[model samples]
Target chain A: MTHKSLITSLIVSGWLALVLVGGCSIKTRALLFDGVDKEPPPPTTRVRRDLLAEIETLKRDLADAQKALETAKAKQQVKTADAPLPTELAKSWVELSELLPKHRSGQVDWGAALQAGTIRPQAGLDPTVLAYAEFNLDITLDRTKSPTMAARGLSAVKFSHAAHSQWLICDNCHTKGFQINNNGTDNILKHDYCDNCHGTVAFAMANLDTCDRCHLRLP
Target chain B: MPAFSPLLFALLFITTVANAAPEVMGNITYQRQGEQVADGTPAAIFPHWVHRVRYKCYVCHFEIYQMQAGSDKASMQDIIAGKSCGVCHNGKIAWNIKFDTCSRCHRAEE
Candidate 1:
């Protein structure tokens, strides 16, 4: 082939290989190191070496953890005197918890008690509606200034005015328990808003389990 | 009997019309935040019928708020400081700010 023709062929192949990158991300880099001459992959040769170094660090952590456990056990021996084994302590709590009903977060699953006819709350706390009521309002609290919450997969909050109004008067929250609207949800996260009662009267927020109790799927 | 029936129908129409009085209707929208409103800043909504059901016009007339909507520009800052809405929402007569979500009053226009 002519020199100019050969040069043109090289340029065409180079453009095709560059297009194989697919996207400007490390994920696309996976296609490169295969010797396809697409793009350079992240430093692959060091990955295994770095992981081996991490294993050594992890071994030291395990040894330190075991030593800390032994020291804690020695301290416990002085307090209990009988110093029950860790397995024995686990059995005791398991047996004790078996007596109480199942729970989701800190909140109890009242479904079991209500079904068994075991619970009978007073008029103030009762949820059953025996008579006609006055005001009716149900609001979904979805406002949040924190951009991280949505990314973290947290759903909006659910509130029912009809339920609370049965036991409490408007004076209980008009400007006190809550505002009409526009109040940021930051207070709810700080354990000051909904947590005021939920943490004490009911189950407080308990990790991801608490998310199911309040942030239900938006239907 | 036929003459009296026409007279009774006329009397009923007058009674119904007299009972009806002109009044400010529907909800009052407060978008005083002004042009270029974003998604989350919030708008203050004044639900008229809900309050009119319990209190008279005097409850929040020229005293608490002006007779017109544009006359009042109650912002969140003003409400929190015990001005426009804070007077009653100070945890005494009504609930205070820390009680619930701010969206209670500050909601996007429907």
Candidate 2:
């Protein structure tokens, strides 16, 4: 072979080798790393046949336990659905609302209206109604701040029990938040109270300048 | 030349991509779903570190198994048909699906 031709052949061979090595390295690296997100802890038990069998038995038992728990939760939900509201007034008020729409349009004397027709009781208690009954007690705040609470050196807030009740269970806050008969003296609506769940667990209650999120200036 | 160019391009592309740190196999045992398995077998605990040392990721991932957890449903029939764990353990490569060594994979101690 000519001297120049030999040099060209050598160059070509080197290029080919580089290409092959590069490709192989990438493939190897990806294979070794893919799906590995974090450095997981070491395994406790040996991956032995006997050990594996025991693990399998344990897993089956765990599945049965989980299934039983789900069944119990389902039964509890059914029981709660069937049970009546605590107060006679709450039960009667809900019943009266349903009958008024279907049976009588005008003036509902709750007891008389309820007696006139088969009381198609409300399906459990309406969450909004419950929140309203629980929070909207007749006792007005003596040191009540205006609707625009921000002007009174507090957060400009418009409370939405309806929206809140959608995600949170009643007992999660009910007596815990304020009182069943709230005198409106408690600072439950403040950041210290709200941020317990908001910033930590749920979406943050930050960006105070974006006042429109919680506070709307009533007309 | 046409085929060679594509292969060359692939090689260049792979080499050009930024390299991530090598994966350290810390937690070795991955729990496979026992609920899917019939006969109430416990979920199989796959020792990933053991297999990782032996084979490359592409040998199974997007091939015999998926990259995500709970995605690859390896059945006995599929294994016997030379799929999944069966690919190696199908008697031809490693151990055959014999009755005595059933606990080796199925693992039913209780």
TM-score (0 to 1) of chain B, per candidate?
Answer: 0.63, 0.57
Please report the interface RMSD of model 2 to 1 decimal.
27.7
| A1-219: candidate 1 lDDT, tens digit per residue | 699999999999988878766554655575555545454546776787789899999999999999999999999877774443232232222342343356665434433433443333223112242423535776776636434455565677667666555434554444543443445666666654555445433355656766665676632
Measured against the true chain A, the candidates' chain A TM-scores are 0.39, 0.27
Give the lowest summed-lDDT range of ten residues in model 1 chain A: A118-127
Cα misplacement distance, residue B2 of candidate 2 (Å): 80
Q: Compose the digit string of candidate 2's lDDT tens values, residues B1-110.
A: 99799999998767653232122222122344556545555444454423432233334544465443455676678878877778888676457887876676553211
User: Model 2: which docking level applies?
Assistant: incorrect
- What is the model-wide C-alpha lDDT for candidate 1? 0.54
Error of 1 at B33 (Å): 50
Candidate 1 regions exceeding 4 Å error are: A1-101, A110-117, A124-136, A143-153, A162-167, A177-180, A217-219, B1-110
The TM-score obtained by model 2 is 0.23
Docking class of 1: incorrect
Weakest lDDT window of 10 consecutive positions for candidate 2 chain A: A123-132
